[model samples]
Target chain A: EPEVTQTPSHQVTQMGQEVILHCVPISNHLYFYWYRQILGQKVEFLVSFYNNEISEKSEIFDDQFSVERPDGSNFTLKIRSTKLEDSAMYFCASSEGTGRGGRPGELFFGEGSRLTVL
Target chain B: AQKVTQAQTEISVVEKEDVTLDCVYETRDTTYYLFWYKQPPSGELVFLIRRNSFDEQNEISGRYSWNFQKSTSSFNFTITASQVVDSAVYFCALSDFNRDDKIIFGKGTRLHILP
Candidate 1:
């Protein structure tokens, strides 16, 4: 089965540095999203992208956070400046389309990128 | 606002035994969706099933079954005669049709299958 693929399975970055997490969504997927989870914490939605624009974002998605679909196949999330609290597992998900979760391409998630900020 | 609660932080069961994980969700929207996903040690998510709030019909797929009761705001998953491979973290997520890609997930219930 086709699945969402993310690069840099694990990343170690210094505080105040910049990092970009990349994802290649399924070929036919239209909706893409970025979520993060701290160890032992619930998964939290950070941002959603569709039609080459941000559809929605959470409070955690501050000015320091930005998501872009630079090209047809690559979707990326850039952290302008990393903080200790920014360390978490970042997940990229894509859906062929959304039909209240019943439709065919219902949110397939990638393995996730473990970001460590020090 | 949406919140899903998997009250049972962890569960333990022996091989070939049955187990059920509870999921309670709170949402204000009338039209929403519920889903169950599994994450193994590899930290990869595996989609299990999806149930819409309007459709209360319970479903059973192979050894997995789901009970979606809107009255109680619960969507429980049951694994029958589970094997060691069934051990993993189970998460329940909630989303609404009105929204495009906003899904909220719970902390998840960790299942441990023993020999």
Candidate 2:
């Protein structure tokens, strides 16, 4: 089965440094999303992208975060300046616009990129 | 606002024992979707099951079963004759159809099936 793939399985960076995580969603998927989970915590939605633009974002996705579909298959999340609290596992997910019978599409998630800020 | 609550933070069961993880959700929208995902020690989120608001029929797949109750706003998962391989953190998530389909996940319940 087709699956989402993320790069840099693990990353360590300084608190003030920048970090970028990459993801390649399923070819036919039109909706992409970024989510993060702190250690032993619930997954939090950061942002959602559709039609090559941000469809919605959560309050946690402040000015420091940005997402881009830089290429046909690549979706990237960039943090201008990483903070210690930013250390977490970032997951990329995608879904084919809508499922049969007009139900919401089910999301397929990647293995996740673990970011550790020192 | 939509929310998913997995009340059991962690559970331990002997091999071959049956186990159930509780999940309760809150969503104002009548049309929504509920899902369960498993996160192994490798830290990958694996899709397990998905149920829409209209489907309340209890589903059974092999040793796995799901119970979705709209009246009580709960979607529970059960593992029958679980094995060591079933040890993982299971997450219950929700998505509102009226919203942009962004999933809201619960804190997850870590299941340890000891041999």
lDDT of each: 0.91, 0.91
Candidate 2 residue B35 C-alpha distance from true site, Å: 0.8
Q: For the second chain of model 2, what is the TM-score against the true structure's chain B?
A: 0.97
Best by TM-score: 1
The 10 consecutive residues of candidate 1 chain A with the worst lDDT sum are A97-106
lDDT, candidate 2, A19-42, per-residue tens:
999999999888899999998999
Q: Ten residues in a row with the worst lDDT in model 2 chain A?
A: A97-106
- DockQ for each numbered candidate: 0.66, 0.63
Query: Using alpha carbons, what is the TM-score of model 2?
Result: 0.95
> Residue B26 in model 1: shift from native, Å?
0.7
Please give, for residues B5-110, the per-residue lDDT of candidate 2 as tens digits: 9999999999999999999999889898889999999888887888989999999999999999999999999999999999999999998765635789999999
Q: What is the lDDT of candidate 1?
A: 0.91
